[model samples]
Target: MDMASALASLSRLQHPFSRQRSGWLLAGTLALGAIPALAQSTSGVDGVWSGTAQSNGQQVPLKLEIHGEGDHLQAALLNGKQRSASSSGSYTDGHLALQFDYYANSIDASLKDGTLTGTFSSRGRSIPFTAQRNTKAEPSSPNPVNIGGDWEVEVKSSKNESAWTLHVKQSGPNVEAVIQRIDGDTGSLFGEWRNGQYEVSHFTAAGPSYAVLRPQADGTLQLVTPAHGGTTQTWTARRPQQARAAGLASPDDPLQHTRLSNPSQPLAFSGKTLDGKTISNTDPDFKGKVVIVSIGGSWCPNCHDEAPLLESLYRKYHDRGLDIVELSFEEENQLANPTRLRAMIQQLGLTYQVLLTGTPDQLNEKITGVEHLDSWPTTFFIGRDGRVKAIHTGFAGPATGDAHRDLEKETDALVKKLLS
Candidate 1:
């Protein structure tokens, strides 16, 4: 079946929340109406707006913060524990436009009656969204619980279990946090404490998520997440005495220990490039070269974090026999695949090749040649002889701070060993 058709069929079997999250994988266009002034309010669009965005039968709360005015305006999107700034924003002719260059997403909406109505577009899909200007004063906390420090958190759900490092800072009731998962950081989540509970949220073109932390009797915090379709998951976290680095696996560690199975096998796969050219593991371009095979997808936020580092490594070591190939397991839209890939490559200034593999399920079956893959952006390091040297699963993006630096140092050392 064609990729688009396959994806459509797969969506029917997935949970409603999953479908809503994956809607951006489809191909479509956003139709925005002309902006007309409301008779009630002539105030410029500068301030904080809070409301819920309904998409794919799910409602996610969002906050839009606009600063400055006119062409000099800047904007930030907030959901739960995520915040992303616009590449550029402008308010002109009663119209609002915000461009997120990182995800190839855009928001075009019109303001009327203290309400902003528009469509959020990513890849090729468009979802309707609305926001109402918040007029209430910022809430203050008389006795705010200090959650500053590093915490080791575990999120367990029926479908998945994962670990995360939550770094929290609080000044009075103002709270700022960053969640470092195996994949990447959750960006900056800004919110305030209320009634002894800490709350924060972030929204982006991809989707929305939030967290509500309530102190437990054992000194740990319970993170409650309300999932779409009436499901709820809780993450429990405790402050560790010492802060540790982020990332699932360290680069200095032995690669064999990180693999789930089949550590000694040479990587093998054949796929078409984004340009429709067929390529294989045995291609002449990769012969005798130290290869880094990146298994990821455009729809993955963690993959977005890892792309720039890969691009840097490629540019620095390509002449020294380093070759990188991104084996992307994209959404089932074949037509949208290239567009998303190209956007990512261009945004990161990546020169390495990207091969369009099938869906995550297909790629897991074909590439791993064993059990299903466990994570997004699993990187395979292949020696000059084309045998797998090590497999590093998951990525700790820059949000991990020192952890990210340590990863770079380890990667550089490993490359030196392979080249020597």
Candidate 2:
């Protein structure tokens, strides 16, 4: 694999959740019902095709099979992992139109020679993909982690704190095990694994997701995404001689005090929504219910990881009179504009109210009264009476292995306790 293809392949490994390698998931299941022969003639969509789907920065290769008999057409999408996504629709004029039950999912282009270029909609979001004719193809290389084994790992960061852990496990392709976070929290080793990697979807009282580990080679793990385009970080871990400290305290934990304890201050600015609606401490909705203010930019990958989780939580608890506000510090000036903000809200199918936060300097003043913040994706959870319940400083993306486990545990306990 050249640099570009290697990069693309790496992307696929990261986001197996959405992309389909073969005939997996949505692309495999989406099929257009029926179309008029005249419509097909005009659309000119009669062929086999191939494509890839990209979300944030992760990419998944896909295969599309389109068989159109006159105006009647049938389309099938095969993802990188052999997941199937199929859809059916008719052509009108020169447009090959198809509909996915999910909104954000879209089909990008019409059929062409042995390929179709388009996107699939899911969770009110769209990731571009393509498909090609079905043929016997080579299977993907086996994922690094063995069913049972000890692996060496390390993480070093000059921009942020550096840490290491021994991921002890017993399982295969997917493993079941525990990861020792260098900056461990309470010696609370979360839960058991089902497949191999920690089952982040489930929860235990002890902790959040990091209980499992995804094996990484001794080489540097380069991080890239739409948000931090040119940013890169090198990380590696060594195998431990014996069982290491489980609840080893992070020396830097004390420095985190300032940002984690105080919550009376607001991270958002006083402004109207994109539609020119006013929002502030004086708003009627602000008077009651726990208000959660999130500082993020649409371009951030960490935000992408946390946004969906936040949106899900907000919807689950909003009816209980819970108030959650998003303060987006978008890099796009257009996104900063109220009109563009409105368009983004519609385009992204966001149901929460998002305000345009000022510059980084201004944001410093907004959250200054509390503690200090360094990252772009910080969340401050307020209580029903409008008091700060918790101040979560950063995101633990799915890639982090164990960060997500701890986050969910903290977030769930806090949210449920407040609701009760």
Candidate 3:
């Protein structure tokens, strides 16, 4: 899909949490509906089972690591580098259920004819999933291709061009990789090397995605990623020695230009806090203070990843002229928006002020006077003089390791310079 279509998909189906208790109850009901007839047998269900979950005609690669015996069971969902552990799970009789406390979601399935079939339910949506245990071990390659190294990758499509770091490690036929982008690491891509091709896939709360890497004759890795909307984009990655350096962009980089028509003009906005108290750009807390206007929503995984760092920044500099105002573009329902924000705040222990900024388009119009909002978790740094100083388009959360560290260092330096 194009960037616009991807953004539309994000804004429409971003919120994964149910606003009402009844919705969660309904999710539980739907989860249990998979097992109508119970047969007692737990054999052949152990070990790592991998498969795909289908939702809205999109297939998400899923890996479930199930362990323990009887009612006391453990399960972990692996999507890229994102791993969610279920606090409680049970494989009793022919029924299987795993509850993820973090997402208020559950996966319920039943074993039948050497295959487990069920649905993954969260919020109000259910995705059908099936998994089969690997009966045959993958044969080790006679001459394993060593693709283990750091690489600079550039992905170009009709919509946009972006740079990233590809970190790959291989042991025998097992290959593990992480794609470090400006926003964050693409979770963990865990797969195996077979023949001359390396294929990996991950399924996260956002959706399911996969990448195929083929080693070219010239030693460059060619990557193909399929979008949920049926569009495929190709990327090329080469080792740092052979590739041009496409280092992560700093906040002050000239290439990091603002799209706003009048950036020097102090951004104007008016919204209510989660408590319904009115707030504006001209509020006393922001006067003469270096403010960071954070544009994000509770429904975004990247936003969730960015929240803790923002909270730490607030705690470190709030008294020293640093103020953060989170303008949340949330679900359409007015009541659900605040509730979601509250949950997010409580979960992250955020002390900064959060306001309801409507949908993504509404936030774009309100802040930049434009109709196009490109990415979630975009942050605008406003100097003490009240003019916009820098605009950060996306967040690279801690999962990116050193990439995230570089972002923190640059952000801290800029904030300090503005404070001075």
Against the true structure, whose lDDT is highest? 1
Residue 382, candidate 1: alpha-carbon lDDT: 86
Give one digit per residue, the lDDT tens place, for model 1 in 342-408: 7666656778888887887776576765343566767888899988777776676665567678888
Preferred candidate (lDDT higher): 1 or 2: 1
Candidate 2 global Cα RMSD: 12.1
Model 3: residue 291 alpha-carbon error in angstroms: 1.5
Query: Per-residue lDDT tens digits of candidate 2, residues 179-267?
Result: 22222221212222233233211111100112223333542221111223423233343344321333222323312533643455444
Model 3 scores worst on lDDT over the 10 consecutive residues at: 23-32
lDDT of 3 by residue, 1-420 (tens): 963344334333322221111100101000101111111224546656667777434455566656655677765554433445564688888789887543445789998988889988765677799887643334645676778778777654221435567877777766666665543345456566767877765555333445667788988898766544556567788877665444532122221623456665787777778778889999887889999888877766667777777888899998899999888876676335455567567656789988887775576566765222356677888899999888776676654557678888888899999999
The worst-scoring run of ten residues by lDDT in candidate 1 lies at 26-35
Candidate 2 total steric clashes: 82
TM match of model 2 to true structure: 0.52
- Per-candidate Cα lDDT values, in order, are 0.64, 0.44, 0.63
- Residue 285 CA displacement from its true place in model 2, Å: 3.5
lDDT of 3: 0.63
Name the runs in model 2 displaced over 4 angstroms. Answer: 1-131, 140-153, 164-234, 239-268, 282-284, 319-321, 336-350, 359-367, 370-372, 384-387, 396-406
